[model samples]
Target: MPENTERDWVLPTEIPFSELKGKDLEECVYWLLDAMGAKDLEWRIGGAGGGAADGGRDLEAHFFEPDEEGELRPQRWWVECKGRSGTVESQEVKEACNNALAYEGIDRLIIATNTQFSNPTRDWVKEWQRTFSRPRVQLWDRAHLERYLSRHP
Candidate 1:
């Protein structure tokens, strides 16, 4: 065995969030969701899925939660992974939320970012949620992702 082999992959805490972006970031979120029991995970292509989505590179998965009748129903989840060097913007988050909400049968929309969201952006999400609620919104930022990494590591 090589004595000088680096274990960077095993020590993800040393890796900065900026190191992950685009498809690389999305894939990480995809695997995390898989580990957390999200079912039928697929890369979203096109806005409607099957091709490039309006959100560009994103993911789709399902979480089975108890319905009103106590039956577990599959709730579709659209995950928008943003690995940005800068803070995640308001308009971009709005667009992603609106797009997912408009899309039929999308039970939840999670905007996962490797960077912190702008204050206004977070506020806007809160306002949007107060007015329009159906597709639940979750913002998983750098801290969240880091926690996930620590748990899974």
Candidate 2:
């Protein structure tokens, strides 16, 4: 694992995303998010092998901000991890998005994938955001994850 220090920072070359499985991939995503300042993290999808019955939520984090009363309130964010190889198509993205939207109490939904997303899937997320009032959606594909690690490390 790479540390946050600049001198210690090294982009992964040995362990490709395609090689990671189950908890390994989820832990990578969790640490990445933690490095990016996400707090109150919870791993909903554990290391135990399971299917997509997790309601499109793999992890949860809280972002604190002051409300109208000037008291800090936690804005819940749900994360869904797709660590498969090849590009994630529009249908897959739509399914994840729908599952996230259907779940309650989340202020934002983040889809983190080792594989890249299709152009149509990206466009669909943009349009979906335009139509919804809450629970904003964000996609973190391979390139995005790389960039984030580079910047934060």
Candidate 3:
């Protein structure tokens, strides 16, 4: 056998999703988005062991889209990371939606969770999209996140 010169890379699929919790999960989300070319990403946590005081957005990012004049307009994205073992419920989604409303200039709100989303929550998101005109809501549950990681990696 030839001498091993290449470094081994562990894909996200090899890691146990349940093992990622709280801050770790949030950081993972940041990395995933960063790999996908999102800019101005920042974790909500300020000091050591501190969380967002507002409990709204866990991460913030911006994606630029060229306007009619060829000016890159920023689309603000607010990402909320949830690392719960159980399925994410409608109440949690509702709270995120409510909190996102308070944030001005946000173009989209993304709820990123390591767990599955409840059917009701999915339906609620659909209804919310129909009712709301601004700040589109999106869900990035386990399957969705895995798909993104697979594509980006």
Candidate 4:
């Protein structure tokens, strides 16, 4: 059978910037994952989701691909989602990179933000790309968010 039920994508311009905080951030990440065609994955809200703390790493999700033997491996990924919170700090990106190391074997580390990172943070990311560039870390800022929304709309 051929699959022909393709849906058009649309960018949402109505999502208030204020609503992308905390729990809303997790939901938005979840929606993005779904839109990206990820299925049967487990995700949880850490840090603040457990109550009150530093509200670190708002949300985390995993995406896996089968190995050569058809075994589902941890060759997955970890996502750190942050809402529009002014400019993200270099330490924040550093934290996500550190977390990815703790996860080991992850194919990628994705930091999705509804905002932009400061100059220092951007430089930090660039340096990361230059050093220990194993678990490819991708920084998705506001522009990426807008594109995702539009493509899935």
**Runs off by more than 4 Å, candidate 1:** 1-12, 45-57
Provide the lDDT at 111 for model 3.
93
Quick one: ranking by lDDT, best first?
A: 3, 1, 2, 4
Clash totals, every prediction:
8, 0, 0, 3
Tens-digit lDDT track for model 4 on 47-80? 5443434233444445667889999865455667
> What does candidate 3's lDDT look like per residue over 118-147, in tens digits?
888899889887888668998998888888
Question: How displaced is residue 112 in candidate 3, in Å?
Answer: 0.6
**Candidate whose TM-score is highest:** 3
For every model shown, what is its TM-score relative to the native structure?
A: 0.82, 0.79, 0.87, 0.73
Rate residue 99 of model 1 by lDDT. 76
lDDT of 4: 0.69
Please tell me which predicted candidate would have the highest lDDT against the true structure: 3
Return whichever of 2 and 3 wins on TM-score.
Answer: 3
Better of 1 and 2 by TM-score: 1
- The CA lDDT of each predicted structure is 0.81, 0.79, 0.85, 0.69
TM-score of 1: 0.82
Candidate 1 lDDT, tens digit per residue, 1-153?
Answer: 858976656555665678888778888888888888888889764444234544532888899999999999999898888778989878779888887765778888889998889888888999999988878888999888888877775
